[model samples]
Target chain A: MEKTIIVNAKSKTYNIEIIDHGLKKLREKVQTVWSPRKVAVITDENVGPLYANQVQRQLNAGGFVVEVLTVPAGESSKSWMNLEKIIQQLAEKHFGRQDGILALGGGVVGDLAGLAASIYLRGIALIQLPTSLLAQVDSSVGGKTAIDLAAGKNLVGTFYQPDLVLIDPTVLLTLKSRCLVEGYGEIVKCAALVGGDFWQLTGQIKSPQAIMRNANALIEASVRFKAQIVAADETETRRRQLLNLGHTLGHAVEQAAGGRLFHGEAVAIGLYQLSRLFEQKKLTAVGVTEQISTRLQAVGLPLSDDELGTTDFYRALKHDKKIKQQQLTMIYLKKIGQPEFYCYPIKQVIGWLQQELSQKKS
Target chain B: MEKTIIVNAKSKTYNIEIIDHGLKKLREKVQTVWSPRKVAVITDENVGPLYANQVQRQLNAGGFVVEVLTVPAGESSKSWMNLEKIIQQLAEKHFGRQDGILALGGGVVGDLAGLAASIYLRGIALIQLPTSLLAQVDSSVGGKTAIDLAAGKNLVGTFYQPDLVLIDPTVLLTLKSRCLVEGYGEIVKCAALVGGDFWQLTGQIKSPQAIMRNANALIEASVRFKAQIVAADETETRRRQLLNLGHTLGHAVEQAAGGRLFHGEAVAIGLYQLSRLFEQKKLTAVGVTEQISTRLQAVGLPLSDDELGTTDFYRALKHDKKIKQQQLTMIYLKKIGQPEFYCYPIKQVIGWLQQELSQKKS
Candidate 1:
């Protein structure tokens, strides 16, 4: 199956192609966009041994010189230390503006390699080959590349779009059960925004095995929803803010949990919290909360903040980079299909969250 | 007097304003664009003692929480070590996304601080107040912020445009004589590209004092020329490459010289070499070489490569990042008014340069 999403960014227009087992045509598909003499395939330790050589060999056989750069696996790899190391490797290998970088792993590899490509020789061609369902559906298509900082997550980054995004869902079959489950939160969030066929499609997914079986359809629906939002606003100014639906509280929850909760789990809890807040304010209908909560539970995602530290979560929220001029702008759904951004004083939101946390504890 | 040139980049549109004493209204003008809570005024050691306090006080009086970040003077300050230090300072001060950075020095300070701002909290507001003639005319106008690498200069950077550029030509009077003279090479290159009035205007300049005396007109012309090219092509893909009329060979020359030759001086040498090459190729008129040589001599710029190692220059050229697939794309003077880009094999250019150097020695 093939789907090409036309992301009409102001710099240039590119596509995101969703294909099954597309590694065979890696060179042919890449050649359609650029004729780079040399290409660097960047992956992480976990994904490198499995797929890096195969991808590099395929490109080499197609008459292009190819090399592989592998970083350690996981989120810690997204750091300035690793960024500098990767840049040194690219420099030592003499990757120039005419060359390209193939980000061939999960979100960590994709982000770090994409950022490296964005700065190498002031900018070069980047082709993303996202392996995980999370990467294929969310991170790869948006063009937001970043590395974690001592200050916060994604504190240092640039909005650099890729020349092309290749999503091969077949790779998800090899992902850990936890990884597969974590990806559903984002897919469900995307479904909430898209609201129609995708919602029905996500609703049909009952377990982790179902996610693997329906990975193609789920990935397509999620990416299509995000692509439309990104096409409208490449940089998150107003319209694109809706995509951050559960992210504000989600980030706080994740930070508070400190590696215990997966990103999607935190986001699932964030979505549940936001729905309740909206219903309390009468901004959303009463059962909008129950509807979203039910969907989250159906997917086996965490629906309540039972284990999270309330104070730590609130503290994390305070340092969030998105907080502007003492006010926090949050995205919440009015109903299933409609999403809106609302601004409230930081103190007000903290008070609300504090009350909710205490009430739940009692 | 003030002139505002609009730079329509893909990210957003910003204005480059050339003013007699732009620093006076720095706070008021900055407030017009953003209501940043706290602002960091970054400068070099040379410029900080002179203007950091003044700029910070002005902003403070205008109700902004202002602080200063001063790095050591000169090009060495544009290093990864300093970048890490600057980022650490920003984090320590709790500079959040709603804050801004004011780059208050020459090219080095502007480039470093601009880059810092581009990555802080994923990106924050940046207002450039160029305090040197070279910065006012060249670096400050284009939003190309970068830091140097061990491999080469500007091997790592991003196309992050500033929110505003404020040029204060009066500050040039306080610059070192050598610094003041170095600024002219870029001015003359801009004059050559603009032709007609600017060319005639450049020919009338007799000395460093004359450049300082006519600083307003000279700075405006140079900035306008660059702004036009940058506006047409925000990323140096096509039309914008013309602005690099002398930079290909210039970078190699600069690299070979280490810290001995300034950027503009190397550019002057590159311009002279390119004119002679064009003349020999019959691409330019017969006396075009002499005309450019005469103009360069009149401005007290170098007319020939002296004290410059020919072998080292060729080796540096070989390692240049701009060389694409073994071919170097160079911009040369087709005539006084016209500039063109052409691709030549590296070996062919090295052979041509070698022959020319040998013939000159004899």
Candidate 2:
């Protein structure tokens, strides 16, 4: 069965199609949304070797000229040098206003390509071919595209929505077991934010394999939940900040871990640590932390990082883009499925992290 | 005397305030539209020496903490290196979402600063303090912020509208004579598009000094004309292409000149040359070329480039972002004020240019 979730952003509205093997119908699916003479398939070394040739042949069969532009696969590919390279290639190839880009890898390729699409000739048609579970459920559904600066991850980016997003659960089969598990961090985060049937569904899935078996349902739920939140707040002025539940500390932890942790792993740890601290402070309902930890651990997500108390972690936390006027808006759960935001001083946030670290060590 | 032109773009609606010594009221005017705790006045070496401190002091007096960031004063400043530096500086300084950037120089500074402001923290408050006549009348009023690339000019950009635009004609007093005359290229282009009173006023003005004498009225007319067109077509899908009356060939001429011709000077030559060719082909009225030539020369603008027939000009023209699928859209005058768009094959455009060059030689 195929499910289509319509993301109604302020700038544009597009559909996220989730199916068993949507890649087989790539040309037909893309043609329905946007028509371009040429399409640049921007992928990374990892996903490109696996899927780029197939995507090119499919689109070529559909009468679209396809060019596969590959970058080194990893977080490092999302840099200014790669961004400039991609844009310069597009221009040198004479990709016009009517041309399009297909981001056909994980979050890094999606972000770098999406940012390129947004600025090349002031934006062109973009279709997301999210090949990973995390990208399908979180990054691909929203229109946030960015390249990292030395200061922080996603410190520089634009909110340019894609024309269409095609998610195929079968592609997730190719993702390594660790990569697959990392995606569940965001899945659990979404489930926690939208607690009804989704949370129950997440709780029932005991392992990564079981979650993959029910991937379609879980992906649809997460996409729908995010679509609703993004539609209401496209620019993250208020409600959109809810989406950053685990990201505040998650980014800091990720930065501190330096390449040892994937994005979702850090987010998983951030989710657990923040909730535990909130419970201790009497802000979150008692036992909510236990429930979150159980769901996360059931999916094999790490609940804490040993290096969480490092100075690099604190520095990354302070450099978060969410900090406005020395104040940070931290998202906490009053209860499962009920998230609330509170403003704290930077010093206070660091103090809470320190307190959490001491308590965990004790 | 002060005149305010309200621009209603799809992304934002802001006022373009034109007055004598408007820099004196910078803080008061900025407070009306946006509130930022800290303001970064991004200026150029040339303009910084003249007005940065005064603007900083004024904003400081209004309880806004002001920081001045300066770059070299030229088109080269609109480079990836400068863009990266500006963005990194903003991140290092911890500029938040509520913080603002005041672009307080000519088109180069405005373009670079505006691009920085748009991508920093995914966007922040921006106020365009356009000092040059060209910027005040054209680039600053529109939400088109960009940095040039090695492949082409404005290949990377975003349509991010400023919260407000402050244009003080008194700043023109400090502009070099060549710079002041260069601004008249865009001013004439605008008058030619809108026709009627704007065109008549443009014709009545005899020289660069006369333009300065009537700067308020001329600037108001040009800004109002552009504001309406931009409001109608913010993304340049259809009607907004009319604004590029001379820009298609103008950009090519400018690129080929290799910094010898200011943007407006190349545009003036483009305006005259394209009109002459259109007249010879009977696509434009017989007197249209004469009228364009007279106005351009009246303002001491150049109407011809000696390097018009060079391969560099042809290459630049072929690389224009406006070229869509080997087809180019050329804007021409139907009469003094009326403009029309005609799509020609890239080959046909080259042929026309070649024929024009041959005829000039004869």
Say which candidate scores most in DockQ. Answer: 2
The runs of at least 3 residues in candidate 2 whose Cα sits more than 4 Å from the true structure, single-residue gaps closed, are: none
lDDT of 2 at B276: 87
Task: Give the lowest summed-lDDT range of ten residues in model 2 chain B.
Answer: B30-39
Q: Per-prediction interface RMSD? A: 1.4, 1.2
DockQ in order: 0.73, 0.80
Question: Candidate 1 docking category?
Answer: medium
Query: Model 1 clash pairs?
Result: none
Docking class of 2: high
**Whole-model lDDT per candidate:** 0.83, 0.90
Worst 10 residues of 1 chain A by lDDT: A303-312
What tens digits encode model 1's per-residue C-alpha lDDT throughout B1-362?
Answer: 88888788766789888777788877777877877479888988899998888788889888899888889998998888888888888877778877888899988988888888887766888999988877888888778888988777888877778888988788887998888888898888888888889988888888888999889898888887887888788888888888888877788889888878888888888888888777898987787677667677776888556634377788788877768889888877777888877899988988888887778877
lDDT tens per residue, model 2, B1-362: 88888999988888999879999998899889766588889999999999988998889888888889999989999998999998888888878888999999999999889988888878889999999999999999889989998878888899999989999999999888899999999999999989999999988888889989999998999999999999998999999999899888889989998999999999998899889888988989999889889888887889888778789999999888888889999899988888999999999889978887978877
| Per-model C-alpha RMSD | 1.7, 1.3
Off by over 4 Å in 1: A305-309, B307-309
